[model samples]
Target: MKKEELIPQYLQDELREINDIRPPYSFEEITKLKDLLDHTLKQEKQLEEAEAYGAIPKEEADITNLVLTVKHFVLQESIKDAIKQLENDIEEKKRELEELKRGN
Candidate 1:
């Protein structure tokens, strides 16, 4: 099966948006994104099955909302990681400046 097929149709637009962003994703990131979507689809199927069996309330088996939440979560995590890296880089530059001053 095509790697893109692993992601549900509903989530394809989000993936495209990610691809359109600057600094295109690496192969590893693409693989991880596919894996994450595949896992999410599996979980969605399980939720649907549970709802069918009456184990979960029908209203609670909102797959659309679940997918959106996952997308939001992934975006949040990526932004947080980028912010952390920037902060670390700023600190490193500060340390370099201090060292240069001391050496003069």
Candidate 2:
């Protein structure tokens, strides 16, 4: 999907509805989320570089490996939540589309 379509501003506004504690996130939260995403991205890049150039050193790379594993676990957990949200959104959209098709 196009970047514009993927992150529509209206959806961003809608996401704020999920935040009831301490109001919606501020720019700081956006930065933090960006940093976390970037860190995961960098880890993926390192894994690719290791594969392409040479294998990670078995002893020294252990920590990085563990970190990557833990990051992946957290990502999977987030993905599950995202999937649930997406499923609900899809159902709602489907219902709306059907209503429109029926001229309701």
Q: RMSD of each candidate?
A: 9.5, 13.8
Kindly report which residue pairs in candidate 2 clash with one another. Answer: none
Clash number for model 1? Answer: 0
Task: State the lDDT of candidate 1 residue by residue for 25-102, as single tens digits.
Answer: 444655555565566567667766787788865444564546656765665565455556667778999999999999
Kindly report the root-mean-square deviation of model 1 from the true structure over all alpha carbons.
9.5
Evaluate model 1: give its TM-score: 0.48
Model 1 per-residue lDDT at 98: 100
- Please list the residue runs of candidate 1 whose C-alpha ends up more than 4 Å from where it truly belongs after superposition: 1-10, 19-61
What is candidate 2's TM-score against the reference? 0.40
Model 2 Cα lDDT, one tens digit per residue, 1-104:
56444443543342342232121335454444446556666766887688566686654355455555666555445445555656777899999999999995
